[model samples]
Target: MKSPALLGRITAVFRQSGAMDKGKGKVTGVIALTLGGLAVLAVLAFHFPQYLTTPDLRKKYDVAILREIMLVGMVIAGGMALANLIRLRNRWLNGTALALILLAAALGGHRVPVDDFPDNTPYVGLDWFILDLLGSSMIFILIEKLFPLHRDQPVFRPGWQTDFTHFIVNHLLVGLALLIVNFAIHRLFGWMVWPPLQKWVGGLPFFAELFLVILVADLVQYWTHRAYHEIPFLWRFHAVHHSAEYMDWMAGSRLHLFELLTTRVSILGVLYVLGFNQTTTDIYIVIVGFQAVFNHANVRVPIIFAKAPLKWLIVTPDFHHWHHSSEREAIDRNYAAHFAFIDYIFGTAVKSERRFPGKYGVLGDYMPPGFVRQQLFPFTWKG
Candidate 1:
């Protein structure tokens, strides 16, 4: 049972002057959830932040600026939540947000911890979750709204809840991902670590090393991505990513846990073996994160992009959208993750005349929706 006031508000919000409609509810809901969740996390991180923030992540920086940013974001998101509630007229809609604000305030919002922090604990990555969620939404959502390739498409299209759940799980479990990958790499490649090799890698200029990292990572990703498409068993899991009918920044986040783990460990192992500097690896991580969201975003490139070299330099929305299109020509094309050159070299690049995908999803439309079903799909699916 829902309130009429909420229903009427949702109707008005959905009926607003732009691409918003019933479909846009997901977008608004996602934004509202993101703002509220991050705000709450900011608070929790302040109270029990010693456990929430990982040593590897916090080694180089402090959370002072981030805490202040969270406080401000909490206030702003609270307002946005209110606006959405008014638009959607939903009480439950704002109730969670209200709870977050209250809890954050009660837990000493914006108050920094002055006590000695413990290093050995189960790291939850609440801080990283807040940072990445807010950062991606602020950057990509803005771009998608301002320059949508699918003009009629809402920010939150169908199946967004599924993708949002995927986003949350992946970000919150960063510690586990890091733990698994690092453990595997160390045990598998430890014997190969040599001082000469390390010195050579460490000696390279920052920019040169960065270039090499991107190239090596993209090369590994190309083959890995191709394998998921070409290999029958792997396709069982990979199909979950392709199952999304809507392509947005969040679309890229809808990956199976197995697919996520294998791909990350594989590429990261290559980087580790090559002895890329710690700083270079860190920067590469940030670059990869940004590119992943940007390439999958529903934003359009200016007409000038078609004539410019930007498309050749890296994967753009147009280039990646073809990869997600349900059209026959796009089924396995544009497999490169960061750079576009590998796709060109291998002839896997999109050669379609379409500027954007008319449709998206697996070719057979076989994969199921919802996070749990998608996660269990590979184990239970029938060919």
Candidate 2:
């Protein structure tokens, strides 16, 4: 399709949602909407388990806590949805909510079996996608509502569907991303590994090892991020991420696939070469994963995190919000991911008088409007 047609279709999708007018469909509405959406995904996963689930995560449904959480979410969300269905008399919310209640009833919430073992199979993080979506939505979305840095910003902002699409693709395709990154690392950096160094690093205490890996990984990322800004060719690809004038949890996932693969491949190569123990690597993954979303989320930090020792220790929403700013002063500043000290040590850090950015996006508003155009954008775009 031509750019005009593509934009029209994407625009039409944005127009069809329940709430797009800078308002969160109320809390009960939020619960109903979320559970309803998850119920649909659950049904899809049940029928198409292989494509939806990862090879490693689903293992016999042995954990009682996991089951309990699912059951509780269903009960609470379903109960409220039902009450509101009768009380509000709104067909759409009530009907959707009623469907979820039925889904919870039919399939047995959290009791559905998902145990499969494949000797060699492709991975798609269906479980991860479901858990992360529910978890992040409840946590960050709630926080943003409670303490919004930009009060006017709504849960369903303009261009939100685009960011949500990016989130789904990135998470659901985690297996593909991992397979490619792992292959590139083993093939390209096999010689870089030293058994002696690997063993020595492994010997360190878990916390110490974790600390070292975070520093090293962020150092690698810091340079990669800087290069994206300073190098014109790379800038086009990175611009897909920066194009979001809105900043929220979903915004962090709005990355160009090329940039995502290259950055991950590079970092994985470095991590593998260093031979960080498996436990150390796994723990760091969780930390970085949470921080990536948290720092981008539209949250207001507590007094402690906003000031003193903690502020210097890690990246805050305010700190990262500046990097996405179109402000001339923040052109390439605040590149550190896990640690704020990296920025302070280097001259690249920007300390501004304002609490947050007044606006966001690429400097001249250069990015195309929709995902289709944005995906093809970097290749055909002219400076």
Q: Candidates' lDDT values, in order? A: 0.79, 0.80
Clashing pairs in 2: none
Clashes of each: 5, 0
Q: Which residues of candidate 1, in runs, are more than 4 Å off?
A: 1-34, 78-92, 112-114, 308-310
Clashing pairs in 1: 6-89, 9-87, 9-88, 10-88, 27-156
Best by lDDT: 2
Cα lDDT tens digits, model 2, 1-383, are 46576556535544553344322234565567577667656655655567777655665344466667666777777777777666664435545666766776686556666555453666578767887898898789888889888887878788888888888888888889888888899999998999999999988998899999999999999999999989999999999999999888889989999999999988878989988998788788888989999889988887687576876778899789989999999889999998888998888878787778888999999898777788899999987
User: Pick by TM-score: which candidate is best?
Assistant: 2
Error of 2 at 164 (Å): 0.7
Provide the lowest-lDDT 10-residue window in model 2: 17-26
RMSD of 2: 4.7
Taking all chains together, each candidate's TM-score versus the true structure is 0.87, 0.88
